[model samples]
Target: MNQRRLFIASCVALIATAMSFAIRGDIMGQVQQELSLTDVQVGWILGAAFWGFGLSILFGGPLCDLLGMGTIMRLAAAGHIVGALLTIVSTNFTVFFLSTVVVGIANGLVEAAINPLIATIYAGNKTAKLTTLHAWFPGGIVIGGVLAFLMTQVGFGWKAKVLTLLVPSVIYFVMFMGQRFPATEREAAGVPFGDMFKELARPLFVLVWFCMILTAGTELGAGSWIPTIFNRVTQSATQAGILQVVWINMVMYLMRQFGHNVSHKIAPTGLIAVSALVAAVGLYLFSHATTVTAAFLWAGVFAVGIAFWWPTMLGITSERFPRSGALGLAVIGATGSFATALSGPVMGWISETHGTAQVLPIWSGLPLLLIVIFGAIYMVDKGKGGYKAEKIA
Candidate 1:
């Protein structure tokens, strides 16, 4: 198999996955206005993507081992195409909500297939490669966010904004077609399904699973609201608010690209533990910013805190629990997205009842809690000979 071709195809697929998020987030206020939806309703609509993503990934994990990653990638592309079309034509709350769900499902499939696919092809370098592959996620967000900001400046409506999702979706679909895929690492190693299931019961896996909930929610939940929250907090231009989304993701893109350097110095859990403290500080300060300059400054801090989180979590699982395979990845990913799904509504209700400024400060608490959890884990690992990846036996 052409590892370069497959890896590039996987990155393109993730770009499409991330575009949906950036576009959806950038266009959210327009959607709310066009549909005459309440903040809570809009929250639910946005949350649907995570819900669809979580459920699809929950299924897509085992299916990767059963049906093949190629099939899952094909389905993801098709879903993105169909979901984009549905979103373009959607005029009401119900249609918009359902369309977002389709996009979410496509996003989930991308996670389900590609995490294991990268793990399989780069078996010896799973963590660094996975981190590099996931860098495209923020790179795609920068693409989508910049496009949305430009379209808004040119007086384009939300429908035109929605169309941008199709570009990457189609590109990835074409790229993935006719390319063969490798078996997942677990399968290649001949790890049984029973062994994969057994890994879930390990205490460390359980702790990581719970931590995924906080990490994913902290990163994704705040991301979905960045445009809207900054608009209210800075009382800035609509277009400028979208630019803040672009700015934060730009920071994330750069940080993730160089993350391997940081990883060489720190274990994943230790890195994430530090990320939690930094994220909490950044979020708290960002919530208090009243000027665009101040908002941009603090958003950078928040980006650095979350930049390594999602991929590093996947890397830790892949390295430390190699026997668990695709099913394990699905579980970690699904749990994170599901937690993110709930965060949308919770944040929305908070924004509705309290105010937009309160959202991030309250959201900061997730990472604060994670600081304690991951710090403890890191200390335990230090006591156990300074953290080594477990081998597949």
Candidate 2:
């Protein structure tokens, strides 16, 4: 199959996942109100999605290598279709939680397949291309937020908002139906499974992986709670929440679309360090913002901070540790997902007790800590003869 076709299909699949994320974020208030659930209860439901995502990719990456990307993607498409239907029909917290878990697993499977697929195909320009591929995540969020916002303007229920994801879901499923998939980078390089494990055991790999936990937490944890927090800060639920999400996602989309240029100028580790500082400050400002204007300004800063963390981390890992293959990418992704999973409840608990105003400031500490860690990585890389971008042959 053509690499462009594969990339397009992967983007379509990811758009479905991003739509689910937007719909879930937008409908938090509605679900809570209609179901008579508390902040903590809603947190559990949301947390289930991140946890399911973590678990699936933790295993799914290896499975993609073993069983092929096509199998994992097909399963992911099925999960999206079934999970969306279940969410539409959910009347209780348990059913709703289960539905998110199913969808989360589907999202994880998409990541498991596409991350490596892009790496394998665009072997020469891993960082730039990977960043370009992931731009669709925010792009999809923009589309989803606009659609959900317009639907709400017309007084369409939350259920209808969820059903919109099926459009992309079916399209990707058909696109992937009869396509042939190339072997993963590791497989093509003939790297042994034991070698992959050994690469992961290196000290540098472990350090970066640890930092990934904080990076993922900083980006995803805040994104998951933005709607609720913004609603509280702005004193508006529907329009304020959806509009804020759209604004943030649009900033992210633009940043990521142009991120390759930025990556060319700055090393990945340097970018991570800068991002951590910006994100920390943004979170603090966002938490303290008393006006909508202030909130949007700070949120733009936050978007800039988060824009490159996910894909850059993947690019760094795949470039530096080429032998680790799908397993390494899987572990990196799983770490972030799991951290987001844990932070979800923590954010909920904070919002439940301390109010949403306190959520961003508390979460800001992770990025501050990340600044230190990424700085250390920069120093270490310099000692190792400067930062050299790696490419898979």
Candidate 2 lDDT tens digits, 152-230: 8999998999999899999999999888998988998777877888989999899889989898888878886786788
**Tens-place lDDT digits, model 1, residues 1-393:** 888989988899988998898788778888888789998898688668778999999899999999999999999999999999999998889898989889999999999999999998888787788888999999998988788878988999999988888888898899888898988888887888789899999999998999998998889888778878877767776547667777888998898887656777898889999988888999899888877788889889999999999988999999999999999999998998888778877888999998878888888899988889889988988998887887776
Summed over model 2, clashes come to 0
Clashing pairs in 1: none
Report the C-alpha displacement of residue 222, candidate 2, in angstroms: 2.1
* Alpha-carbon local distance difference test for all models: 0.88, 0.87
- Looking at model 1, report the run of 10 residues with the lowest lDDT sum: 233-242
* Model 2 lowest lDDT segment of ten: 236-245
List clash counts for every candidate, in order: 0, 0
